[model samples]
Target: MTLLKGWRYGAFVGFIAGFIGATLYPIVISPMINSDYYKQIQKETRAGVNQEEIQPGNMKVWSDPFDRKK
Candidate 1:
């Protein structure tokens, strides 16, 4: 019974903390961050691009760490 009571108290505290965080995020933290910049960049980057030709800048050519060949 004691163990179950402790679990219930923990769960209730966690729920209250999560609720407070969710309610405060938009009002307190959203304006301080430039979230729109990321969205705009996403829109511009995906606007016009050829998928057939892979851009050299986007390619990650690196040897795998697990490879036995030196």
Candidate 2:
């Protein structure tokens, strides 16, 4: 019983730590790591080349099927 409880406690702690790390990495770590890439994108955008036609694997930059702006 004691061994089982210890295993459960270790598993719970490990799971919580992993979850926190995963959550914080994208918000805190990724931007810092990719700062150079982001700067390049900003430069391209400022140069008016950011609106290139989307390719098959690229994300949809914007869409409005309902013509809501008009």
Candidate 3:
């Protein structure tokens, strides 16, 4: 009974290790193997952030273009 339990534990550990390795292998290699994938993603995010940053002060509120109550 004890020997069977030990083998079961070993099998469980092996399954977990294999699952993690399979998942991580692609993520670890993708950025290194295809650099442009991450670069393009980051570039788009930065451009969106910059657009939002610029719009607040430099852009207009056309509804109040003529006058203001406050």
Candidate 4:
């Protein structure tokens, strides 16, 4: 009976921790991990600009954004 009580307590704590983490992930961890492309899209949309107009150019610092050369 005592062993069963310990197991119940452990399961309850685990469930609470998991719920809190899921609730906070988008609020806390999402921005830090979002890609630059997605971030740009969000920024443009919020500014009332057309998303398609915000196209990416060959703007990489160390490499091209294409496979073929001119």
Per-model clash counts, in order, read 0, 0, 0, 0
Candidate 4 at 58: error in angstroms?
A: 36
Model 3 residue 25 CA deviation (Å) reads 0.8
**Model 4 poorest ten-residue lDDT run:** 55-64
**Best lDDT among the predictions, by candidate number:** 2
Runs in model 2 lying further than 4 Å from the true structure: 1-4, 48-70
Q: Give model 2's TM-score versus the native structure.
A: 0.53
For 16-50, candidate 4 gives per-residue lDDT tens digits of: 99999999999878867877768798787789755
- Angstrom error at residue 42, model 3: 10
* Model 4 Cα shift for residue 54 (angstroms): 24
Which scores greater on TM-score, model 3 or model 4?
4
Residue 56 Cα positional deviation in candidate 3, in Å, after optimal superposition? 16
Candidate 2, residue 17: Cα displacement in angstroms equals 0.9
Q: Model 3's lDDT to the true fold?
A: 0.78
Structural similarity to truth (TM-score) of each candidate: 0.42, 0.53, 0.38, 0.48
Quick one: how many clashes does candidate 3 have?
A: 0
RMSD of each: 11.5, 7.1, 11.2, 8.4
Ranking by lDDT: 2, 1, 3, 4
Stretches off by above 4 angstroms in model 4 are 1-4, 35-38, 41-70
Relative to the true structure, how large is the alpha-carbon lDDT of every model?
0.78, 0.81, 0.78, 0.76
lDDT tens string, model 1, 1-70?
3553677889988999999999998887885596796789878997876654555777655558898985
- What alpha-carbon RMSD in Å does predicted model 3 have with respect to the real structure? 11.2
